[model samples]
Target: MARPNLTRPNATRPDAAGPNAAGPNVHRVQPGASVQAAVDAAHPGDVVELAAGNYPGSVTIATDGVTLRGQGNRSVLVPDPADHSACAAAGNGLCVTGVADDRGMPVRPVSGAVVESLAVAGFAKNGIAAAVTDKLTVHQVASHDNGLQGISVEMSTRTVLTENEARDNGQAGIFVANWFDRKGGALETRGTQVAANRLTGNRIGLQLRRVRDLTATGNLASGNCGGIFVVGDDGVPRAGSLSIANNVVRANNRYCEPNPRLDSVQGTGILLTGTEDVVVSENLITDHSGTSPMSGGIVLYPSVVGAPNARAVVTDNILADNLPVDLADLDQRNGSSFMTNSCRTSQPAGHC
Candidate 1:
């Protein structure tokens, strides 16, 4: 889809020298100014061009419609270089602290926002968080080395997250949670797209929970606890759909003793529990090795955290070298089919 070239009320677009053509209302964020201050000064359709510098603070954005494009992805929203020692001391000091886990004030709510071309690191928590918002687009951003997820979208609809890099997070790289308390308690997630991103060195590359009608395509996931984990909460998973294609999942270490226990180090390349009617197809899954017998290329079981035994579909995936097993722990109540999967040296023809 083509984006408009309009400027936000107070925000400015980049100039001739920057990545995108200079829009009329672009603003330049200097070294000393606070990130919050720059956000405050920005209006809808504005672009905040950040120069290379160390900014020590968090920013909360309330603008409903705007574009925040950084000068360059890597140099723009990086951690404060001055705080390197403190960051190392603090452990995983990248961007804002507590961006996920129902904490922190959001720079941009999950609704009606657009953020692109920014490098966000050292967040004590998530690099970017979206909750209960709609029609948000996050593109060309780099989120890494945070305490929690690189980016989290919770209870939002019609959101597009594309061409982003989520890596080295202490927890899951990207988590899409669509659980919200509406009138009389209901859950809904419509049309969420996660595409063309690189996720590596996290607990889980992408976690989808309590939502459906989603698409995850053209992504690369490696060196994490799990490549992709889809789960439901409390009860049987609803009748929703998830499509994953053209992605690479590999080398997920189940026992990442560095953080320990906070994540499921003994996890799977793709785990489906209490999640039904999902699809895993045309993806490359390889080199999944862990100490536990339950760890496999794809794992389907009841929940260790919540309820269990849901239906799912696992088909047409290249499963190779998944150590200990290829597929394991199918729930007795689970309703699914595993067909056309290429297993490597596993028993029962892909059954563990």
Candidate 2:
């Protein structure tokens, strides 16, 4: 498939030289300056550039075709005790949201926004939160030590999250959902891509909840309670039609206590629950060992709401040393198949 030509806002690095160094479209903010002020003053095609220093406040981007960039990891955003912005009040380090309806669904998505090359930490909620956005690109950022997801996107389409680092977040390193506050059927993401990222030490590395038409590829996940999770429930248009490929998942044995919604998570590499028409292929999974019911290399299990997975294809993967088994298809209602996988053991045997 041909790659789509994603729209990008005008951007300039903080250290660039020559005529484009500080163009008229660039809004530069120093350490103590207000990033929100610069963002508010920017036009649709403008770039809001942050200098290499600590910025102590949350920032919200509602304008279209804007880019918020920083000087690599040296540009840091932390929570501010005195800030009263809606994003700060929501405990998010950075937020991009469009106009919403009465039901809190976006009527018009924020379009063509890019966020890159910064570090966001120590927030009470998600580090980077994007809701109802279209064609958003998040690249080369470091998000860690947040109370919730490191980077989260909900009800977004054509979003690209690539080459970022998410570590030690309280929840999933990267989370994508149809809706965070309500229970509903899967929403099509229109080719959202999560690729080439590094995820470690979070409760879950990457989680896809009630969403479809997305791809997670070329990622590395380890030291999390679970490497990757594709979850659905009893809702209509259930989560499926996605691809998980070319990922390196290893030793996701970090123990996490059971939450109200599910059991304890540990030693889970790739888990698919209540999903259908999903493809799991070309992954390297190893060394995930635990006694948890979800532990394994590649697992197909029933959802929390007792919906069984169907029509899942697990093929051409390499797996080793996973506890209980390398492949476990515990779903009773079966349309799932495991073929041509290189593994030692399986739950019902002969899958390898």
Candidate 3:
């Protein structure tokens, strides 16, 4: 679902900003007025331009090089899933709060931000919620049914959520978080770039909480329940380099989650619990089976008994019929490193 360009060109804003001399570059958005009043009357290298249809509310892009484009999927914004009071104070529907704004006083962040080709749906929360962000950019948007995430980046840096279209979101359909730094020790989202997205039916179709230098490539996480979840909520150590390559991760545990800690991540397909130097390569990760016998296709949930030192390297992926085993490893992770994975089955026995 590519080619819906909105004048692209936001490769994580390498110095972005254009049209100088105090004003005008492209600030359309004029029919009846709104879209945060044209982003509070544009400024730094402006370019508001939203003129297709339903733009109900929530919009916040505290100007930097702002470029909230539209008119691709006929520009829709929906919000009002209970009124976020019009977003950006704490609420979000399209809030790219980068470079600053963290409630009480923290300032200076909104760097070259850009949200393109709009279509963000019903959001009571995230449908694009960039946090202490950096050079942000979310292109070809189509974030659907969101009461929560459909693109939520926290503590962001070098952010670049590409070719977007995260579906049915109630939480995670492309989420890259990190933060922890009050007393929780360090951890701040390092250079990130979850590319070529299309994560389906949400609940964890591309997460990466407690992130670190990441680069989840060519995504296509299917049916979501656990298509690509990499956690480490707060063991500190700021996670590690995660480079999940060439993705296609399918049939992710299709909906269980009545909340037994999210029903142990339903029907998995790439669940790396206590994140570490991860790198599940050359993906095609297949259809995860249901009814939770720890449904799978790449489960490496280590990190409690002894903690910290949880590595991963399931290489050359193409994993087949994902059920109770397509490559399991629940804590046998003593520096984990499964070889040439073309998975059928593999546990604490032999690298496979």
Candidate 4:
């Protein structure tokens, strides 16, 4: 086991140099200094303390076990619109990727990474993505106004995304997706915890896709197209389990035809597709605007072949005043089951 010392050797001084000390280095990286220069100079467990300014550059964290903090989320690591094209191929504004699988999938393991206290915004892609690395924790990060998702944890396990705020992204706020290159399977995103997030005004708030034994709790999602999208795949969603509890999802729109030339999504509050062993409880879902002729507050549909029985236990929820269509539309073969709850307009009386 590694030593449990919180202080890294080179972290003590910004200019102290040696083998035992890369020198307590406080590099004030301006337009000329590369972001990779700061990262290369940092030793393991060191702190890359960014100044209070807009860094119009890209940063890739290659070292393990380091802390990159800033004066505040608002002033540090501001995305430059000019660099938007730089991230078009990578899929994230701040990309930290690892190895990929034979089926063109990123393989993530749980250990040795932490991204905290950075406010990343205004790129042409997802805000921050950590792929194929684990034991990772992203906290106090604000990601907004990106081309795609605010934050994406693709093929990652044992990750904790907490206290993050995602808003006005082109796609979902937080996405946990797996590559679908191989026919047999994509690896599971197990033991992942997404808690205490404030997601608003995005296409989809939180999408837990193809991950088993995942938990999304204590989050607030509002004014998005959909609040939470839990998906299961033909090969993976059958055995996966998603736990969505203690969230406040409200004012979302299902089948939203924002303009006359756009397509529509199916469900508004929670769209469960091709997954099993899901439990959505203790949530407050209200005021969803549905437009499609076949839309619902909560829709559970399966899209796999020859899979086991998919099950979703939805209880103790306050789903009220959702309209333009049905409240719940379930169309899978013996679809996701729901027990004693309230989809009524009123809470105690269960009026719809």
Candidate 5:
């Protein structure tokens, strides 16, 4: 399927007055009120405007074209242990779920759902989680201190996650995956974008796993165990066809213990594994120094499942002060090349 235009119109702004503004179509909820009730009662193209206060409990959005807007970061959403809503029960602060198959793959994605200008923190799982949603826009939200991901999108396409602040999360600040619990071939994201976000103090700043046809650009990632990770596996269709460009990734030197899926990670910047046809260009990766095997600038390692990267293009990046080497092509897969990168050192001796 062709990708939809991900831009939002001015009329969709929180202050905009339209047929759905400040009336029956717009549902305003105060701090103690139920956000879920307004969400449930909303029709398509309606706005659920939240007042500037702390809202407890979790809410779920299943309806299409619903805009959940808040008064900037002053509107905060926190966990309510006593609230047994499905979103809270699942340990997510806010969830947008759509029709899925028995295997948990999206069959019919929720369309035109927006979540913006709010803060969500201290959730056991993700701050904001979306599964099987298309053209889902999450912007200007502050997601921090979540147990899992700050913002997670899975089995979805055409997602726009821009201008968000994600920090101090246990896992990736922003995570995009085909499926979290299952193994499969890479899904085609059809122009999903992760752009212009500030990410710090997470295990990994950003992670793109088992997905293709995506772009991650103009972001700042620092102070994490790893800056960015593009991971694929032995699954068919293999993750690739993506662009990682024009980003600043630096000083990801925090030490994170080995998890069930990965070894101890620290001081890594832009690690790409088991992917094909990926472009890593115009990024400033610097000041990452650690003893871990994965530590370096633009390191390409084999995937966890031992699949090697192929046909990757590493070009036009400014790399400096990375430990072990600036560019380490540990995979040395076929048809991969490094050219025109301004870096001091590399494992193979002459790629720089």
Candidate 6:
């Protein structure tokens, strides 16, 4: 689908230059100018462009229907020294969030926002985050070496993370979670897309904690702790109407956080912890060369997390099965189906 070019506003055709091409609604920030100030100054349908420089402090975007465009990697934001004593300030580099009321409930939602062409790194939490927002788009951004997820959508619906590069983050590169710990309610993600992204050297490439209508496609993941983690074990419902298709996942379990509970380090091409009704199809799952039985082409951790993952379809995948097991449905959760899979070893011929 063709998105409206925020640069032209009324123009039906998308302009290649976007808001950077210069217009009345475009605000340019110099090296030391505060990005948050520019966002505060911008109105709806406005764009704030950051010039190339190292900025300090978290940039809060309380505005709605705005675009924050950085000058590629040249625009960097470090942790706010005031917020923390050290570099890890525990705040998002660029935060698109709404205001809260007296009871700490969100009274407003910062919707229809876009953060593009920024190299977001360092300073505590996610490189870019949207909390309780809707229709947010993150495009052509390079987020790496952050404290947490490179890009995070927490309690946000209708979000898109596209053409982004996430690497060397402390946590998952791209994370879509309900933030139930903070919000505490029944969660249902609707209309979320994670496409054409490259995630590497992170704890997990793409971690989907809980989502209903989720689509993750045409992404590349490698040399991470894991790849394509479909998790919803704690208290969230199993993910339904989800699709993880046409992705390249390999060389995971490369870095394992030492934990006493698990005796071995484990990772997989696709780790379906406690998700159901998910269609994992047309993915090239291969070369998961790790020692842990948990590390394989495809893994299903049943009964270990939430109500055992049931009613899933694993089909049309190329599995190298280099690890201990290619696909493990050992407990065989009810309605666990498999079909049309090609594997080098450790898989039955018949479809399950």
Error of 2 at 147 (Å): 0.2
Pairs with steric clashes in candidate 5: none
What are the per-residue Cα lDDT tens digits for candidate 5 across 111-178? 88989999999999999999999999998999999999999999999999999999999999999999
Cα deviation in Å at residue 107, candidate 2?
A: 0.2
Residue 252 displacement in candidate 1 (angstroms):
1.1
**Residue-by-residue lDDT tens digits, candidate 3, 1-352:** 1221335422222222455444435666643457776676666666777778887778888777668888877988875554445463344678877554444223566776788888888776688787775778888899889877888877667778888898998888888765422223224555677888898988788877666777889989888877887767345664657788888988886765565343456788887766677888898988788765456888776443334336678788888887867888867845768778776677765655
Clashing residue pairs found in predicted model 6: none
As for candidate 3, its clashing pairs are: 98-109, 98-110, 99-108, 99-109, 99-110, 100-109, 253-267
How high is each candidate's TM-score?
0.79, 0.93, 0.37, 0.81, 0.94, 0.86
Residue ranges of candidate 1 with Cα displaced over 4 Å: 6-24, 78-110, 179-186, 236-240, 257-263, 345-352
* Predicted structure 6: lDDT: 0.74
- The predicted structure with the larger TM-score, 1 or 3, is 1
The residue-by-residue lDDT of candidate 4 on 146-220, one tens digit each, is 888898887777788899999999888998767422343534666788999999878889977667777899999
True-structure lDDT of candidate 3: 0.72
Off-target runs (Cα >4 Å) in candidate 6 are 1-24, 83-89, 99-107, 180-186, 234-236, 258-265, 303-306, 347-352
User: What does candidate 6's lDDT look like per residue over 56-143, in tens digits?
Assistant: 8777776677887888888777776664422234467777777656644556778888888888888577887778887888898998
What is the number of backbone collisions in each predicted candidate, taken in the order shown?
Answer: 25, 0, 7, 13, 0, 0
Give the Å error, residue 189, model 2: 0.1
The digit string of per-residue lDDT tens for model 2 on 164-242 reads 9999999999999987778888989999999999999999999999999999999999999999999998898999999
Candidate 1, run of 10 with poorest lDDT: 179-188
Residue 5 deviation, candidate 4, in Å? Answer: 7.5
Error of 5 at 181 (Å): 1.1
